[model samples]
Target: ELTNRSFEDPPGSSVTPSGWYDCGFEGETPPDILPSPTLNIGKTAYHRSTYLGLTVRDNNTWESISQELRQPMQKGACYQLEVYLARAHSYWGISRITGKEANYKEPALLRIFGGFDGCDGRQLLAETPTVSHTDWRRYVLQLEPALKPYDHLILEAHYGDGPMPGPNNGNVLVDSLSNLIPVDCNANPGLNKNPEPEFAKRQMLSPKEADRDLPLPVSEAAKGEPISETQLLELITTTAPRIAFDPAGNLEHSHYTDPLTNKGKWANLLLKNILDGLAQHPLAILVIVIPEKDPNLAALKKQNLKEALVDLGALQEQVILRDWLEKDVEKVWYGNAESGVLMRLIR
Candidate 1:
């Protein structure tokens, strides 16, 4: 079994978790241990109290970790391994190339290598496709080293064959590694399959049509039904214009002047409607639907709207952000960014 396989560390600590040696580029900082109060990017652990955060910097230097394997990986022997991976929406760092702060928010792939010693990446064993999801996802890799037996394993973050520009900023979360299970070398590992968890339990509270195929919640809120969901949605959207995000994830027309009020659109009418609804029904909640494309950009959109709401006096806890998964993958490039978000009031 792998030591500290879950990448456990003290809560909110940035030190490297025990059992793994930093394999980062020379003259650069080591990989960070995350969810610290200062690094507060809201990345929760996939298995335990903490997880490993690695980045591929814009300067072309990436983060990695290495450890000695308990047993040698024999040549021609197929091994199946499972690992959990994710992409953080906000991984901030200073760019060595430009001398400015940058968000390492792009998606990067995880590569595994086998070698004889420390940080040895001489033999490429297996690699997962770019991990773009914000939630914890398990990836299974089949490794069969054609070369000689090796005793060390190195995990690296590298820019695989992606269309993005060279040497861009990206990050990947690592946690909950599984032991390498020996398998028949002749047996086909087949295609890589990523099992998506059942749709979130918060779907019932979303503004989208409830008839869509998705898992439902187990129970309802305890508050008395002071305002129906329909009534609450109507009240909030009555004067509030639909908000959309631009290609850069910036809010567009969200603050256009209302002909009657001549003020920030959301600042004046949208905020009033939300506060008014809460006044009548204190148990009501605001749900902000965010798109599921570009984990980082989606996060940007959610943060922008949430900040707007909080700045205008809506209690932070009262606002919720739900991800909208676009079923048709082909439309990701062509879909309207404005339709990405839909606000709803639910109990």
Candidate 2:
């Protein structure tokens, strides 16, 4: 099951909703989680208090959000999800190309990408033609990953062929996503599996129900500057003094960390280390080592760690998860050991 599937996380003009990470360009602002009065969209949410607002700008860049899935999507498997989509004709933004205010009223389409990381966009799984409706409408997207398996999903707003063809301002409102359901790949495509009148009722949760299990907002006192790489290295060295090292004093493995055992202070420290590292370097990628024994449990373990990190506000592109034994025979899971999580610097 997906966490915060209905986009129930709190909203802000620039803040990425909880459980989702921004995947916009380097210099671009992140997508807005909205229903804010300041945006002046003059729209109520289709489901709860807020919805996702994505834009395709004239500067050839667009907005998107991604999250690591609780379960990896199996290759060649078919999955469908229901969501509400609408177009806000009064949406406005400052155009980068024109250097002035402009209406982002043009319709935009939704593009879904699946990959092994939070923002890889390795495979384009599904795309809608365009959402031109001013009222909330239900859309069931069918995704079939024909290539490799995927553990992450991305929702992107893209330009559509409107009356004026070239790149311009466009906005799409997304809300109330249903659970991702697997179906028969060969079944008649585009047919609604559940045509009952109460289908919509089941998709949307009440406000009280939506708020349940949601993470509490981070207070100002809990926020601070991220730690530097140098600081992080020192922390690891000081905290894990018994860690095995090579002749050159480089890290070989940690004696204190055994993912299956000793799940207390050391584990929390390890999580903190990861959180600090990702916060400092937002673009870095993670590499999770999947062991041969109980591969399914290993996948679930990785998902749990991912959710933990995301819950603590770590939003970088996560590691590409795989069964190391099946993918490679020469390279060991963690240099010499059988299991552990590895963080790699992409630079």
Question: Best candidate, TM-score-wise?
Answer: 1
- TM-score on alpha carbons, each prediction: 0.56, 0.55
lDDT of each residue in 1-347, candidate 2, tens digit only:
66666576566676677898899988998877777766786565654357889999998899999989988888989987667778988887798988899998899988888976678999887777678877666666678888988999999999977876568899888877666789898763653332211112311233654431243232222244566665544443332222221111111211122334444211233444545555665555545443426554465455545554554456556445444545455442232233334332333
lDDT (10s digit) by residue, model 1, range 256-328: 3444556533232334444555655667776666654667668867765666566456775677765775542
RMSD after CA superposition, every candidate:
14.1, 17.7
In candidate 2, what residue range of length 10 has the lowest lDDT sum? 246-255
lDDT for model 1 comes to 0.64
Enumerate clash totals for all models, in the order shown.
0, 1
